[model samples]
Target: MRMGGLTVWFWALASASALLLGPVVSSSSTTWVADGTVLELDDSNFESAISSLDLVLVDFHAPWCGHCKRLAPQLDAAAPMLAALKNPIVIAKVNADKYSSLRDKYGVDGFPTLKLFIHGVPQDYKGPRNADLLVRYLKKFAAPDVTVLDSDSAVADFVEAAGTFFPIYIGFGLEESVVSKLALKYKRKAWFSVVKDVSEDVMMLYDFDKVPALVSLHPSYNEQHVFYGPFEEEFLEDFIKQSLLPLAMPINYDTLKSLDDDERKLVLTIVEDEDDEKSKNLIKILKSAASANRDLIFGYVGLKQWEDFADTFGANKKTKLPKMVVWDRTEEYFRVNGSETIGEEDQASQVSQFLEGYKEGRTIKERVGGSLSLTSFISSFLGLGTVYVLVFVVATIILVRKATEEEPLRVGRGDEVDRATSSISEAESREAGEKED
Candidate 1:
């Protein structure tokens, strides 16, 4: 079978089996707001609390936004649990309608934007809004990035019991942490565990001799790959990429060179960071996309690492990661717009549409910046308004000062004229008296 066909088949099977699980996980809760848990905030406490708190989850919402209204109660219920995390996170809400300053500052374009302030830097929360999920996600910020499998039972249950359905990334023996960073990086994609202090009996169960070894076990895909350290972050990433993509392959230097010059169009995702939610989720979404469309070759390229490759199509300059594009192997690439650079959860429909257009021999072009046009227009308008206001104010101030100074000068001139007139009248009277004598 063709590479694209193989990719499509593999992902479809994984998703159908629930190995690639649906993203959303939800729960129930009561109507509540900052009851010793959540904080009711305006401009006043927003900055101070976010800056002061070790970790905080701030909801930027407009009153009229339906999503914001729906999310309110669940957020309120999740507040206490989130606050009760190890580092004790603070949950705060801002009415974006009342405080446009905060919303605009944070780049909150949507109605309900969840910004998680970790040490004062705001990060968008990409997980589910369900109270339980929110609490779990918030709790991760407080907990250790990697959880060590302490017991033989813990290792068995977490690793062996994960079966082939879930991707279990195991960091075996001598875990001062060679791959801990990688484990954390792939947290959204895989279950990661480190065992630095494993008993000899438990260690023998896996039958690996290396002091620091990393293994990926996936039962659903029936795959097992092990790598012995010195494990760097890059090595760990490459390892996982090779393992998960049994049918669908990762886009890299060697892979890019290997693309057949046939009629197959390459769907490449420009990813900057593996740790980012957008990049990771986009990869997952593409896996499903590959499953559906067996004819199209779908893969991702890391924009940060592969500057030369990104420069080929000017993708390197794009500040955003997880941007999709379609290449026809004709020295040009057409960007695919599924929903604004990995923000949408359901990208399968849009991706499929792009593929259908290609199949029908339609000329699919790159997405030009409507965003750029709109921003430039708004900026130009604001710039003009500021200049007009400043000019008007300056002119008014100059006019007022000129009038005040002129009034004092006019009064002095009038006094001089009166004195001269009195002297002239005295001189004429003296001459007349001399003539009469």
Candidate 2:
């Protein structure tokens, strides 16, 4: 009996020792501990850091990149604010230039590439770069999928807290269950809330006339859309999808990619400059048109901001300013026969006419390569300079063929060849003058 008791005591002592030392061993192995500072990571610890954290924002950047240098201060300032939240999000970075394998693995093509990792899943970060904006943007990921608002003040507070980055959806006189699934479905794209107790003033504020209404607000654009219906899953989803983007969206590389799943044709407006007063006025007119025509996407791009992209639409320094076209967001685009350009005078009327002509099928279909064209593929593989050279060669060949076909009998005569070349140059100049006019 004495021997058996001693054996049991020894086993008990061993169990106590393990209980005391197990946590220390685990803590020593943990290389990443969330303490409110930006963590510098490399290949050795990058996987372990991201895999252990629930949410992480990784900046793949190079030391010599000017933009990366500018962004470092912002991340440093926002790290502590984010880490103080109930659900902390780790801010981390990897020197992509030094770590070539890590850079290629994540497809880090540009400097200061921000990517958010949620439960080990990677997504491109498209939010603002400012310190305060970064904090507000990252907080969304840490927040609840569906926030509950009881009073009018809570609703206002929720809207204020959501900021102007993502669309806000508030469900009034509706059960949380109705939008819970949708909130989870589009948690990354929008902010969802349920207002249990609503006031008459609140209803009037949101411009909703009836109960069981879903008010979707694009605060950045000062636009609101209300849906009052059976609230079936399909109908609700349709409304949510439509409210994801504002009426007048600025066309850029990122915004273009965001429209991949949207089936609507884009009524693209190319302007001299998007930030100028004239362009701003044109955008207002386009937004008014967009309000009436929700089936189409109204977008505007600036010639100076993205000349290369505008070149794809036949818009260049020589072409008339404020040109309009209907693009299918792919290979084919449609140009209205009569309303091709919006004049400075009677601009609203011109836009209306363009829309009417487009709807009446008074359009000419033209094929053009988009971002996924062979030219872009070559540019990506062999650099943009090569694409420019290829385009120049093709244009020269076409011009030569036209000149030869026009004067076949004078091909052997040097004087005739010189005259043909002069004629071709004059024709090109005239074409450019016509485009300018």
- Estimate the lDDT of model 1: 0.56
What is the RMSD of candidate 2? 19.2
Q: Tens digits of per-residue lDDT for model 2 on 1-437?
A: 32333333232222212001111112235656567788899988888777777788999987766678889999999988887777788899999867867876776545677899987789878788999999998888888889998998899899999998889999998899999999998988899999888899998999998898999999988999999977999999988987788999988756765676689999999999999999999999999898788889999999988776777787888889899999986557999999878899999999999999999999999876543355553333333234444555454455455543432211212222343234334334555666679
In model 1, the Cα lDDT at residue 138 comes to: 55
The TM-score values for the models, in the order shown, are 0.46, 0.73
Cα error, residue 253 of model 1, in Å, equals: 27
Runs off by more than 4 Å, candidate 1: 1-36, 156-168, 180-192, 197-211, 217-225, 232-234, 240-437
Clashes of each: 5, 0
> Residue-wise lDDT of candidate 1 within 1-437, one digit each (tens)?
12233232222222212010111111232222223356777776666565456566888876655567789999888877765444566678898756867765776544577888876788667556888767755554655556677777788876543434236777777473666666566544466778766677755666566567777676554555677854666756766655544334466533544343235677777777544776666667777777566566777767666554555554556555456667765435675444335546466665566666556655447532322232222222222222223344443455456643321110011222232223223333444555568
